[model samples]
Target: MKKSLFTFIILAMVLNAFTACSSKASKGGGAKLKARFEVAGMCSNYTFSVIEGRINPALVEASWTNPQTNKTYWKAFGISNPCNFPSNIKEGDTFYFEIVPAEKDSKCAVCMAFYPTPGKKLNIKVVQ
Candidate 1:
């Protein structure tokens, strides 16, 4: 009987300690990916599915790479800095640009996605 009571007390203490320590980090309250995408596209209000490849910066110009087309565009779509992905982004403040494909069936030069830049700024270029 005594052992059982002591075990219960120890377990209770451990659980309580864990709960208290776990909450040390304060959550700043961030919007989800869906909300972030929607906010970014307030201009065009575009939304798309997740695709392969990471976000590409708008540094290389002239020829854009798109994952959708697997080809390069003659002219880059112009994506600027401080941009975030169209989907699964943390904050709405992140800026994002799409790689304009050269043709109907081609890859976005920046990302090389089959369908690049659904809900994003039309033209965002890397500053010289």
Candidate 2:
């Protein structure tokens, strides 16, 4: 009877472990991808560049890239820096931003301000 009880406990522990792992995976295990973008160029209140092989100003342009998959995504930014208005970025400077799917198909992306430094990872939740 003791042996049977021990076996049952072990099986229960194993099942619990598997359930926990699966739950974490479903939530992406808190995993986020870092999407990288280069500052192709900047214009009046806007920047131009190609992300994920797609031209800028797209209705659904890449606003961020997933580091894990290196995949680009589009998210909307309500407010962004106006640094690019007067053209402050250099030729090869890289900037990161977030994007969201537009309600309607258009040829423009709502990109946030461009950051000269590629320091910490970009967070789509916070616009900076």
Error of 1 at 124 (Å): 32
C-alpha positional error of residue 22 in candidate 1 after TM-score superposition, expressed in Å: 0.4
lDDT tens digits, residue span 10-102, model 2: 999999999886655333233222222333322322223322222223223336553434644453111233322223444344443343222
Q: Mark the regions of model 2 whose C-alpha exceeds 4 Å error after superposition.
A: 32-128
Candidate 1 local accuracy as lDDT?
A: 0.34
In model 1, which runs have C-alpha deviations exceeding 4 angstroms? 26-128
- Local distance difference test values of all predictions, in order: 0.34, 0.37
Clashes of 2: 15
On residues 1-128, what C-alpha lDDT tens digit does candidate 1 reach at each position? Answer: 99999999999999999765543311101111111122222333233321222233232233444554464433233223223233344322333233332244433334322334432333222111
For every model shown, what is its TM-score relative to the native structure? 0.22, 0.29
